[model samples]
Target: MSKVLQFACHFFAVCVSSNTPTAVYLGIMKHNGVPVDADLMKSRQQEAEQQMQRIRNEIIMLIGDVEIGANCGTKAFEDYLYQTLKLPVMKVTASNKEAADDASMIMLKEWCDANRPELSSLFTLVQECRKWSKIKSTYIDGYLKYLNSATGRIHPDFFALSTETGRMNCKTPKAQNLPRKSNDPIRVRNFIKAPEDHLILSLDFSQIELRVGAFYCRDRTMMETYKNGGDIHAATTSVIFSCTYEEAQDKHRKEYKEQRTIVKNVNFGTFYGLFPKGLQSTLKFKAGVEKSVDECEAIIRNLKSGYSALTTWQEETKRDAAGKMYIETWLGRRRYLSNIRSENWGLKSFAERCALNTPIQVTAADILKLAIVRILEGLPSRPWLKPILQIHDELTFIIPKEKLNEAVIFIRECMEQQPFPEFDLPLVAEASAGESFGNLEELEG
Candidate 1:
C-alpha cells in the first residue's frame, strides 16, 4: 500500500476504537456518496461473521467426513488456510506442516473476489473481527501502559460537561467514555489521574455472571463454583451435556463460541426462558434443525435439574418487569420499558430485552459506582497511587515502582469486598501490575 493509504488505514483503525458509529458513518459518507440501503448494508455485516463460520464449518466437515485413504491435494489447501487467515480466536487444525485443515483460504479468496468493489469494506470488517478475536485485548494493554508511564500525570482535558444533560462528559479520546472494544479500537480512552507515583486501584469479579446466576436462581451448584473459584461454564456444560466436569471442560477447550452460547442459554434461560430451539441456537445450532431441537431439550432439562431457581427467577423477573413497565438500578437509574406494554410487536420485543437486561446491567453498574467511591476514600494512606482511568470493570493507575504492590492490595480490597448480599461468596480477582497503561498484555511482572 502507498504511504497515504497506510496512514489512512491506521487512522481509520484509531477511529474505530473511538466506537462512534456516527463518525464512522460520516467518514464513509464523505469518502463515498452514502451507500444506500444502509440498514441492509449494516445487517449484511452479519454476512462477515456467518461467512467466516460457514467457511470454517465447510473446512471442519471436510476433514471429518472425507474418506481420506491418503492425504493428497486436501492437505495443501488446509495449510494455506492456516497461514492466511490466522484467527487467534479460532482453534487451529492439528496439521502444522504442509496440510490445511479447512478451506478458509479458498473461501476467503472467493469472498474477496466476489466483493471486489467492497473489498475495502470487507477488509475493514475482517480486521475488526480479528481484533475482537485477537488485538483488542492488546489495545487494552497499551492504554494501561500509558496511564502508568513515569512522566504521565493527570491531564485537565480529560473530563467534560454536557450542557444538554448537565452531566460530566469525557473529552478527547474520551477515556471516561471510550467505546467498548468492538469492530475497531474505537478511540483513545479518556482517563484522569494525579501523577506517576499516584495509581488507580481497580477490581472486578472473576465470575460475576455465575454470582448473578447464583443469586437470581438460588442455585447451590452455581454459588458453590463461584465460591470456590471453580469453572462455572464447565460445570454448566457438565450438567447440560450429561457429562463429567472433565468432559465439559473438554467440550469448552477450543469451542468457546459454542461453549459460550450454551452457557449463556442456561444462564439467561434461568433469567428468561430457554426453549429447546433457542438453546440449540445459542449452543451453535448450525444447519440441523433436528439436532438443535434435541440438544435444546436436553439443555433445558439439565438446567432445570441443576438450577431450577433460575427458571423461577426468570418468570418472576418477567412478571415483575412487565408489570412495572420499567426497571431501575439500586440507585434509581431507570430504564423505561414502555414497550413491555406497547401495541407494536417489534417495540415490545426490544422492551422485553431491555427489561431483562436492565436489572442485571443496572445492578452491576451501580456496584461499580460504589466501588469507585470506596477506592477513592480508602486509598489516602497511599497517596502515590491515584485514580487514572475507569473502563467498565477495569481501572487504571500510574504508580511508582515501589508503591504498586501495597497499592494493588489496598485497591483489591476496596474493589472486591463491597457489601453485596452474598459477601461470603468469595470474591475472585485477576490482576497484573504494569509499566504503562496502553495494553493489558504488558502488565508488570
Candidate 2:
C-alpha cells in the first residue's frame, strides 16, 4: 500500500480496535463520517443471528408438546408452569398480573425459585435464549443496520454524564450494556477478537466493593481479614457462628456453606442498607434458605454486632446525608442527595441508602477509570499493547502473546495503584488472556 493509504487504514484499524469513541476520533481527525469494515461486520452479524436462531429452536423443543390452554396460555397453564418450574405460586400469580408479557431476569429467577439446583440447566437454557435473542436483535443486527454505510463501522455515541454514578454510557449499540461471560451457548463475546498474533487480556478488580467498604468503615475484623488475604465471607460466617474457618469448612460443611452464603448476602446488602424483609426474600429465593423476617433480622443483628464499626459508619453516613443533603467519595466525587430529607418514608429511605452506598461504589468507579487512564498512558511506551475495551471494573487489552508476562504485571500494577493513600487497603486485580474475548482464563499472579 502507498504511505498515505497505509496510514489511513492503520488509523481506521486503531479506531475500531482500541475502543476509541467514534465521534471523538472523527472530530479529532476532522472527518465528516466514520467507516466500517462492512464485509467483516456482516459475517459476524450473520453468525450471531444463526446461533441465536438455533437456541430459539432448542428452547421451543424443550418446552415440548404442551397444549396452548392446558400448559401455556390459561390460568391452568400458569398453575402447571409454576408447579413444573417450582416457582412460588403466590409470587408467580402476583407478577403475572404485574407483567403478563414480561420475561425479565427477576421474573425468570422467580420462576426458577426453590428448585434451582435441579432445574439450573433448564433455567440456563431459557435465560440464555432470551438474553442472546435480545443481544442478536438489538446489538448485532441493530449495529449492522445502523453502521455508517460509507465507513462500514458502527460509531456509538458515548455520554459521560448520563449515569447517576460517574460511569460512561454508550448509545446506538449500547456497547457498555452487552452480556457478560456466560457458560451458555450464547457467545456474543466471541465476536470481539484480537488481531493476528494479538490476544485480549482482561484485568478486573477482585472484591473491590468489599475492600472499599472495609477501608471506609475501618472495621477491625474486616480489615484484618482482608489484609491477611483471608476469605471475608467465611471470616464473617465464623464470627456469626463462633467457629474457625477450618471448622466452618469441615464440620457440617454444607450447613456452613449456607451460613457463608448468608454472610455474603449480608455483606453485600449492608452496604445497600437492605432491611429484614429484603433479606428474607433474597434468602428465601436466591439463597434457597427459607428464613422469616425475624430470622433475617437476627442475621442482620449478627452482622451489625460483628461489624460494629461498619454499621456505625452506615448510620453516620445516613445522618450526614440527611443533614447536608450530599455524600462524597474518597476522591471528592460528590453525589447530591436531593431526597435524603424528604418527608415520605420510602423516598427518604431510598435516598439515605443511595447516600451510604454511592460513595463506596463511586470510589470503586473512580479507581477503575483512573486505572484505565493510567493503562492508556502506559500503552504507547509498549508498542505491542492496545486497549480494546473496558466493561464495568474490567479492562481488556490486545497484546502480543510473547509480552503476556510483562503485560500482566504492568496492567495489574496500574490497576492496583491507589490514588488516595489514606483510604488504604490492598487492591487486588485478577487477569486473564485469550485470543477471543469470550474464553479468557485466570492469570494467576
Candidate 3:
C-alpha cells in the first residue's frame, strides 16, 4: 500500500498541472446538469416502442417461430441466418462463430440485393428493428434511468484521463454518444432542450484531425488544399479516380458521388497507416461500398502518390516508435507502444498504426482542451453562458437568446486561437444555434 501510494503520488504530481483546469471545468459542467424535456422524451419513448413492436411483428412474419432473442443475438437467430436462410457468413465472432451483428446483417443485405432479391427485405426489417431497439433501450430508457427527479435533468460524469489518447469520456447516461441528425431517426437529441428563453449553441472544429495530419506530414498537396480553402475530400477524389478536380467535385455525377465518399473515408484513415484489407473492410462495412482488396490497394497507392509525403512520414514515425517504444502529440503527451517491437505480426502492426494515429488524434484533443480552458477563463464575466457538453471536436453551451451573437463570437475566438506556438495552420470552428440540440442552424460569419 505504501509503495502504491508513492507511485500514485508521483503520477498525480506529473499530470495535475496539465489537467487541473479541465478537471475544474468538467466538475462545474456536471453540476450544471443538462436540461431535459421529460414530456417530449416520454412521448418519443412511446413512439419508439410502437415502432419496435411493428418491426418485431414484421420480423416474426418473415422468420416464422425462429425464437430469435430481443436483439437477434441468439443461437436461434444465428441458425436462421446461416442454416435456415442460407445466407453466407460475411463475418464471424472472435470465437469463429457466425456473426449476426449489424455489420454482418448489412453485408448480408447487400448480398441479398445482388443475388437474392427476395431476402433483402428481411435484412432491412431486421436492421430497422435493431435500430429502434437501440434507441429505446440504450438512449431513451438508459437516459431516463439517470434523470434527476428534482432537477428534471441528467448529470453525466466526465473523465479527462479515461482514454489513452487524452480524449474525454462521458457516462452515467453517456451524453457524448448522442447520435447525429443523419443517424437519429427518433430525434433523440431533441430531448435536451434549453430553458425558456435560452438557446443551444455549438462550435465544432472543422476537419481538425486532417489539418493536423497535414501539418505533421508536411504533405504539399494536403497543406495546399487547406491553405487555399479547397475541398480536401474532393481533391482526394480527383487523385484516387484520376479525374479533374471540377469533375470530382461535380454534384450531378453519380460516379463522382460514390467515388468521393470512398476517397473521404480513405483520407480519414490513410494517415493512420491504413492497410488494404482494413480499407476494404472499412469501405464495405462502414460506408456500405463494396471494394475488392486489389481496388482498395490501388486507391491507397494513388493517395500515397498524390500526397507523397504521407508515406515518408508514416515510415519515419514507425521507425522512431519502434526504437523509442513510444510516440507523442505535439504538446508532448506521450503514449507508449510496448508492442512496437513484438515478433507477432498483428500486435506489431497494431502498435505501428497506434504510433501514427496517437500524435494526430491526441494533438487535436489537446487543442479542444485548450479551448475548454479558455472558455473556463472567460466564463466568470459572462455568468449567463453555461457550458453543457463536449462531444468529439465540438463544444455545446446554453446561452441567453439575446446573447447568441455575443456567445458565438466569444466561443469561436477561444476555439480558433492557435493551440500552440508551433501549430502553423489556421484553425476554424463553425458555430450553430437553435432552441433544441437537434435543430441547430449554422451561424454565418
Candidate 4:
C-alpha cells in the first residue's frame, strides 16, 4: 500500500491579484487544498478541471473517511435524506375539513414520533414536526398561497436560509426552525439515523464564546480567570465590580450579563460606528435601565481595552482590505466586505460588520475544521466512538453504553491537543458526553 501524500500545517497570508471574477475562486481553492495559481487555473479549462479533482481528493484525505461522500453537498444530502427518511409531504386543501389521501400534507409529526429512532437529529426534528402539524393549517395555506409553486419540495427549498450568502438554514420535515436551532424530539433530527453496528458520538465545548473572548482579549487579568477555572461572565463581573468571583454571582446575573453584552455591543460598534440610540435599545436594557451616553462611551472604552487584539485586527485587516471586498481569517478563510466601499449607508454598515465578524467567524470555522480532521485521525484502530454530525462548533458522536468515561476522556483529548505541535495557554475544552445533546448539557439533580 502506498502512503497518502498529504499536506497540512498552513499559515495564512494576504494574497493580492488583479481584480477578476474567476481568479478569486481559484485563489480560495488554492488556500483550501491545492496551490493552484489563479492565472494558471483561469488560463486553461483542462487545468481547472484537474485542479478541482485535486480539491476533491484533498478533502477526502483531510476528513479521513468516506461517509461524508454518501450525501456529498446540499442537494445530494437533501435527496439522500428525503428518500431514506421518506418524510410525508402534504399540502393543505384550503377546505374547512381535513382530507386524507396521497395529496394530504405528509403528517410530519406522525412520521417523526412513530418512525424515528433514538438519534439526536431525529429527536430534535420530531418535536418540531408535531408542533407544525398541530398549528392551524389555515395559516400555513395562507402563507403558501401567495408564493409561486416552482418551489417543488418543502425540505430542499425550505432548508435554504439565504441565497446571497452561502449559508443555508433548514426547518424540520415540518416548516419550523433551522435544524440546529430547533429543539424538537422528532422533526428535523429524525432524518438522521445511526448504523446498526455503530454508535453516534456527540461532543460540544462549554462556554466556547468565553474561551474565544479570553484568547482575543489578551488581558492577563481576563486570561488568568479562564486559566484558574473561574466562571468567565462572573469573572468579568468581578473585574468590573471590584468584587470576588463568588461575590459576583447573582441569580439573575444582570450585572454579568450587562458586561458580556457590552463587550459584544462594543465589539459590534467598533466596526459599525454604533449610534447612542441604537446602543440603548439592546436586550441588556430590557429592564428599562437605558444605557446613558456616558455608559455607552464607557462600554466602548472597556471593549477596546478588552479585545485589544481585535482593535489591532480591525486596523490591520482594513489596511489589508483597502478598497477590496474580502478579509482572510487566521486559517486563510476570506470573507468578502466589498460593501464597505459602497455608497449606500446600509451596505456600508454591513460591510463594516463583515470586517469585524469575518475574522472571528472564519477563525472559529477554521478551528472547527482542524479539530474534526485531527479527531478523525486520533481515533483508535477499533475505537467504539464514531462521528455523527458537525452542526456548527458542536460535534455529535455516538458512544457505547459502556465506554462512556473513556469516550469522554478521548473526545476531550482530541480537541485539547489538536492540529499538531502545542497550543499556548492550553486550549481548554470543556465537554460533557451523554445520551443526547440536550442530556449532555444537563446537570445531575
Candidate 5:
C-alpha cells in the first residue's frame, strides 16, 4: 500500500478500537429513545404560532406592511433594517451583502439600545418573531415529523466518529441541539417528558473544558482555582478588573455584574488564542457588553500575565505543531494540521489556533467518552438507569422517581472518576432532576 493509504488504515483502526465502548453505549441510548409528551408538544406548537403571528403583526405595524417571511430572511426585511430603519450593518455573508443573521440582529439591537432607543422596539419585535418561528418550526414541527409511529419517540441517530474532536453528533431531530431553559422561552425541552413513575436526571460535568484547559496549560491560577473549588470566572474577573475577589464576586452591583459577564466571555475565548478584534466583537455581539479593541487587548494582557503558564503552553504548542505538522489530544488522538507551515497568513493563523484548541477540547472529549465507558460497564447492575442522551458534557437519563438519590450517586460517581492517572485535577459532575427535561432543579448533596 501507498504510505498515505497505510497511515489512513492505521488511523481508522486506532480510532475504531479506542471508541468501541462509546459506540456500544450510544447504541443502548439509541434503543431507549427519548420520551415525548405529544400533547404538550402540540400545545406548544399552537402557542408558538400564535406568538409568532402577534409579533409579526406588531412588526408589520411598525415597518409599514412590509412582507416579512417566517424567518425574517427576505431581502425586503434586510432593506427595511438598513435602508428605512438605517441600522448599521455589523456582519455580512461571504457574498458581501448586508447581513441579517442572528448575530447581526444582536448587534443591531445593541446599536438601538445605545443610539436609537425609539427604534429599539422594532428590533425587539423582529427578534421575538424570529425566535417563536424557530421554536415552532424547528422544535415542535421538526420533532413531530420525526416521531416514530410505533415507538412514539423521536429516535435521533448518533454518529460517533463524524466530528474531528471525537464528540458525537446527533441528527434527524437533532436532540442534542435543543435550547437550554435559559434560552427556550417556550420551554421546548419540557417536551422531553419522563413516564409517570420516572424522572429525567442530568449529570453535567462542571466546566469540563476549562478544567481540561487548565490541565493542559498547567496554569497555576487556574489549577489552584479548580483545586480550591473557587469560582474561576470570579478569579478571572479579579485578574482582569484589578479588583479584590470579593468585589468581583459581588453580583448585585451593576458594574461588577457587567464586568464579570465580560470577563467570563473573555475567559472562554482566551483558550483559543482570541485576537483583540475577535474579543471585542464577541463581547459586543454575543455578551451584549460593548468593549473597545484596546480594552479587550488590556483584558487579554491581564489574563496572560495572571496565568503566565497559559501563554507559555500556547507558544510551545504552536511551535510543536508547526514543527511536526500535527497535534494530539492528551490521550494521543492526532489531528493533522497541514496548513501550519503554509505561507498564507490566514491559513497559518487558523492552523495555529486549531493547534491550541484541539488538544484541550479533544482531551475533554476523551474524558467524557471515558466516563461514558465507565457508565456502560456499571449499567448491568443498574438496569433501571436508562441513558437517553449525551449532550456535550452532560448525560441525560430516565430513572424511577424513587431511585433519584441512588441514580444520582451512581451517575455522579461514573462521571467524576479520574479520567486518567495523569489528570491531577479533580473532575466534578453536578446532578439535577425533574419531571421534564426543561424543569430540572439542581440536586444538593
Candidate 6:
C-alpha cells in the first residue's frame, strides 16, 4: 500500500504509463490558469540572439588574431596564445570542419588543457552564449509555439518516477528544466504566472542535500555549523582559507568571497563525487580561479584531508554498491544498478558515483514525495489552495489572496515535519510569495 519498495518493479514496467501524482496535480492546477508573457519571451529571445552574436563576433576577432602564426608552446607564447587570445587547445590534425572553418575544428577540452589559465574567460563566454542560445531556441520559441493560443498554456508531460534518483522529468515543452535563478536574459519561468485573484507561493528546502550529507557523514564541523545556525559556506571558508570566522563573515572581502565560492563548489560537488579535472573546470569557469590539473589535484587532496570522513564514507558506499550491484534510499526506494559490476572503467566510475549520490538524492526525493502526498491529502480540506509546479527542491502553489497566510503555515509545517525516521535533524524550508511565478519575495516568519 505504501508503494515504497515498488520502484524496482515500476522502473521496468514500460507497458504501464498513465497519470502519476505529478500529472494528477498538473491536471488539477490546470495550465490555463498560468499567464504567459509572450511579448517578454519574444524580447528575451531577441536579446539572447544579440548576446550570442556579440560573443561570436568577439571570439571570431580573437580567432583571426590567433590565425596569424600563434606558436603552440613556450610560457610567454602560451600565455599570449591561451590566456590573452583565449584560444582553445587544438590538435593540428585533419577535421571535418577544416574545409568550412579551420577554427571550428579545434577541440574545446584539448585547447583548454593546453591553456587553462588564459582560456577561462573565453570558455565562460562561449558557454554562456551557447546556454542562452539553447534557452532562446527551446524555451522561448519552441515552448511558445507549443502554447495553446486560446489559453496561453503549455501542458508538458511529467514523468513521476522516470529518474533512478526519484526526480521528476518533463518533456514536450520541458517545464521542469525552465531557467529559474540564472542570469540568463530569456528565462521561461517568467511566463508562468498566477491568476488575477491568486498568488504563487514557493516553498523550497534550504540546503537540503548538504544537510543530508552532513547527517550521513557525521562531519563535526558541518554539524556544528547547522546546529549553531551559522552559514555553512562561511564556516567552510574559514576552515579552508585559515581565516577567522569573523573574517569569513565579511561577504564583501575578495578573499572571503572566493573562499566561500570554492567551499560551495566543494560542498555540492563532493557528494556528487567530483574528480580533480571536474574541480579544475568548476574553479576556472564558475569560481574564475584558473588552476592547472596539478593544482586542482592538490586542492582536492587538501579538501579530502579536511573532510576525510565524507570521502571515506562515499568510497565505502561505492564499494558496497559495487558488491551488491544495487543501492536503496534511506526510505527503502531501490535503484538496481546493473552496471555497478561493469568491467568498463567509465561505466564503473559512473555507477560508483551513482552509488555515492543516489542515497542522499533519492532520500531527498522521497521526503519531497511524502511532503507532496501530505499536502495533497490536506488540500482537499482547503479548496482555496492548488499545487502548481514542483522544481527540484521547491514546491509552488497558487492560492487565493484570503488564504495566503493559512497556506504558508500549512506548507511550512508539512515540509518541516520530517516524514522519515532516519532524519534526526530538523528540515528548514524557505517560503516566498508573489503575484507571479518569476517574481517572488521571501515571507519572513
Candidate 6 colliding pairs: 83-118, 88-111, 89-111
Off by over 4 Å in 6: 1-23, 26-33, 43-132, 180-182
What TM-score does each of the candidates earn? 0.54, 0.73, 0.93, 0.51, 0.92, 0.78
Q: Please tell me which predicted candidate would have the highest lDDT against the true structure.
A: 3
Native-referenced Cα lDDT, model 1:
0.48
Runs off by more than 4 Å, candidate 1: 1-171, 176-202, 250-305, 328-333, 421-424, 438-445
> lDDT (0-100) at residue 148 of candidate 1?
22
Assess the local accuracy of residue 222 in candidate 2 as a C-alpha lDDT between 0 and 100: 91
For model 2, name the residue pairs that clash.
Answer: 35-151, 35-153, 36-151, 36-152, 36-153
Task: Return the clash pairs for model 3, or none.
Answer: none
Tens digit of lDDT per residue, candidate 1, span 1-445? 9966875776565334322332332232122211112222234344434554554454435344432212223444334334544422133345544422223322344455665433333333333344333223333432333332333332223221122211223333234544453433332222222234433334445555456446555667777877677888778877776677777766446654565555755664555455675555544422222245766677678777777666666667667778978664433345666678788986876676666555655455445444555665565565655455444455555567677677667767765775466445665555655433323332332
Q: Which stretches of candidate 5 lie over 4 Å from their true place?
A: 1-17, 80-88, 109-119, 250-254
- What lDDT score goes with residue 312 in model 5? 97
lDDT values, one for every candidate:
0.48, 0.68, 0.88, 0.44, 0.88, 0.71
What tens digits encode model 6's per-residue C-alpha lDDT throughout 1-445? 4565466556434213222454566566555344566777778878877877777676556544443211122244345554775564543325421121223222454456565645445545555555666777778887787777787666666567788787766677666676646555654676777778888889999898888888878777778788788888877666666777888899778776567777888778878888988898788766767668986677677667777778888888888887888986665556778888889988888888888888889777767766776676687799888776777988888788888889989998988897667677668889999886777899997
State how far residue 8 of model 1 sits from its true place (Å): 52
lDDT of each residue in 1-445, candidate 4, tens digit only: 2222221122212112111211332222222221112222123334324444554455445333433331133333323334554544433334633232221322343355566543234323323333333321212332233232342212112211132222222222222232333433222333233334433445655555445534544557556766787666665555444566676676466565656555454433444335555666553333334567767666555555654664675566566665667765544445667676889987876677667555555445445445544565565553666553445456556556566567767666766654323223455555554443333443221
Better candidate number, 2 or 5, judged by TM-score: 5
CA lDDT of 265 in candidate 5?
89
Candidate 3 residue runs with Cα over 4 Å from true position: 1-17, 114-118, 252-254
Comparison by lDDT, 4 against 5, better one: 5
Q: Candidate 2: list runs displaced more than 4 Å.
A: 1-97, 101-129, 142-156, 180-183, 249-252, 283-290
